[model samples]
Target: MLEQKHMALLEEAERRAIAPTDNIRACFELLALTGAIDRDCAVRLARHRLSEGKFVLLFLLHDKPDGLSPHELAERAGVTRATITGLLDGLERDGFIARRGGLEDRRKIAVALTEVGRQMARELFSEHTQWVASLFEGFTADERKTLHELLQRIWRNLDAGKQQTGQTADARA
Candidate 1:
């Protein structure tokens, strides 16, 4: 009762459906692929955010309105305070960010992006949008929509599974 194309797609989906070890490997592989892409993009963008700075800032700011101190940023980013110190220096020098002395504790330095930095962040975000658009360029609108929904569901299921198991899906790896 199914069309040939539909049957073929179903078969392919079955073939590629997340299996035991493949799930962990696939996640790691995806991270690796993204790492490679980020490495290349860092050079192309000449931006630290494209490389590592943005991720550090994002994680720190995710739960707080005020940005993280340099020490906090370095800790979250898994770098030394000295490294963050230099990174902040470069960022501030480029007019991409501004730092303020802590209100109650002047010893602490709070870091945040300036207007120019936010604009750069917007531009970086657009780069991702463009990349995603190009990735699905061959897909129809319906297919793209379906794929997005399916991926979201898969991610949710994976997170739920991890929570329940208390072990990484890495056992399958």
Candidate 2:
């Protein structure tokens, strides 16, 4: 139950200005925690010369030996096709991925990992897995489940708010 460094400042600022209720304060805490996790992970990934997005692409490609199309990768990675292309270019240049025409659909090209890429994926994934686990090492299984459910509820609430506001899926981008 360790609090973030900014929690005290946040409490002070809220008390002096726009004071949030307990529920709203909890929401802010969750947002801050998620942001911290994302920021720290990005920094760590930079040490491996990888961005979070590139790591995701490599990991996804590792599980799909048959390879995926750029369109498929874009969808799976939740990014635009243009972004996937850039990722593929960097990976290809680094000898981590190769693109080839489909045997069945000659017009379509698929991206797959090289042997070097596979090894890189395994090593990176293993270490990153431990790093993430370490962040929640003290949480019991039940507490973890409760936290997951709570987060999902918050996500649904936010998504529903977007829908109510006439926001299209594209608007999220």
Candidate 3:
């Protein structure tokens, strides 16, 4: 837990040394400097292995082990169902996924990663994770924890702001 004095010091540092707008700009700058945008583009390029169809499915599957339906993918990725459908179609065409009739009934189609897809997802996820980890090699564990907690709280405040602006759903939507 943070003491009030520590919180005040952190707040004072942000107020005096880092304007909110400037901090946001710096974040973008750091992303660019560290080539996170480039990394994302590389991942996007790997999609061309099968029109990024398999890659997106693999990433989503790995992100949610229980698995995600095409509709869930669209919501999580902030994409349209048609887009997810297209991606799934291409992935299925490439043998990275398979569709099964719903267990209890035969009406719904559920998708799952094929073994090949799982292997590919694991490899890509590991590669990207290593790259991200290398970026913070200088931070100690305690610093990392502190940063994580502060960022989480800040994120909540930002979410609250979005709610206030009607950008986020009401009732924690």
Candidate 4:
């Protein structure tokens, strides 16, 4: 169910022969929902002086006490090494993380969370879990499972389209 304004826009597009099909409308709604979620998440992180990238880095480091290399982090985060480097710089400056020689390979560097970072991750994970769970509060367990399956189907469709078009995941970037 779209908002009144969105419905009106869709109707207008159809009237003008813009061909606003059901698939397009569904895509639009998905984008709008994701945008709202992103905004809300940003606001929540802002309260703790953290960005999404920094939070993700902290979350990853929190689970792996031994830490990860910059390349590994970038791959896991689905970001570029340069992006990870920038995030690490800010986290290190804020005393949230430290870069030290790798345990097994002294030549390589590992990014580990500081004690402060660990504490922050613990606190944020608690609040974040609750907030995320709240988003699906209206759905029953079966509905949640169905939604997950539907979302996975949509993702597969997207992947198929990308493959057919010879477009890599990072092409949009």
Candidate 5:
């Protein structure tokens, strides 16, 4: 009825008996939209020889000159240690990242981007920024701001729920 793919999908989902509650329907819509955005972005990055996780790691490291530990990267990426380790390995192999001895202990490893990594990160991040901007070209500045605030609020609510359930609420992903 809304003449939108997301709304149409939600309607179809409801017809198929996927919990008709507004909250659940909203969740489905968000998931559909997010998944499509993520998929398209991933393909775009893949053409540039990057994975979604690696792109995220590069951006994260770009913000922190001091770098982060593997544990920290895992937490920030909302991924498992094994997954982070694999991503690091691939990036490192491509000369995009390097692991050095931690300051506290020789046995501890500190993960960071190499010089080449920094250059690539900057280039890739610029492209990524432009690509994402194009997706929201129709949105006014106020609309974009409102969308961000609403999403942030949703994240905070989910994080609060997690905390209430005695779970660690490392909410950024």
Candidate 6:
């Protein structure tokens, strides 16, 4: 099985004096699993002619009917304004979105989904939901809840590490 292969690799690593502690093995496995998941998700999105950024922008605009400014979209999407501009350009070229003057302020531009875009989002949304649900098909409801809690704990640990690093840097400064 896959688990046996992983165990054999870990054993080889340990035999080679590669310092394969339990924590190190756990971290390696987690990173490998997440990297594979990310790659698979990207492949799925590409089937619809969407990069992750484009897909995110599409859904964000889909949720916000009125529209959002380039700056706002960049912040919401966790990308740079320049990156957002490139995505918007591609979406507009494909006729999936439109950039128009804001209703409240004519000078300000807001991006909105066109009818075509809305229709695509609706279809993609359903497919995406099923795809995500499939990822958890092996887990029971309680197992899913436990997994969520454990992931949250890991996130908190990462956040705490970041804060500690910042404090150390500030102290050195």
Instruction: Give one digit per residue, the lDDT tens place, for model 6 in 1-173.
Output: 13556778777878887774676578667877887778888999888778889988889999888899999999999999899999999899988899999999999999999998898888888988898899899899999999899876675457475575554544545
- Name the regions of candidate 2 deviating beyond 4 angstroms: 1-19, 159-173
Give the lDDT of residue 160 in candidate 3. Answer: 74
Residue by residue across 6-103, what tens digits does model 5's lDDT show? 67776777788866658766676678778888889989988867899998999889877767999999999999999999999999998988899888
lDDT of 3 by residue, 49-139 (tens): 6544445667877645445667877887677998998888877887777877756656776778888778777877776678668768999
TM-score of 5: 0.66
**Candidate 1 — which residues are off by over 4 angstroms?**
1-36, 47-50, 54-66, 136-173
* Order of quality (lDDT): 4, 2, 6, 5, 3, 1
User: Going through the candidates in order, what is the number of backbone clashes in each?
Assistant: 0, 0, 1, 0, 0, 0
Work out the TM-score per prediction: 0.49, 0.74, 0.55, 0.78, 0.66, 0.78
Q: Of 4 and 6, which scores higher on lDDT?
A: 4
Which residue pairs of candidate 2 clash? Answer: none
Candidate 5 RMSD to the correct structure:
6.5
> Lowest summed-lDDT stretch of 10 residues in model 2?
1-10
Worst 10 contiguous positions by lDDT, candidate 4? 1-10
Candidate models: Cα lDDT each: 0.66, 0.85, 0.68, 0.90, 0.84, 0.85
Q: Which ten residues in a row have the lowest lDDT in candidate 6?
A: 164-173
Best by lDDT: 4
132 Cα displacement, candidate 3 (Å)? 1.6
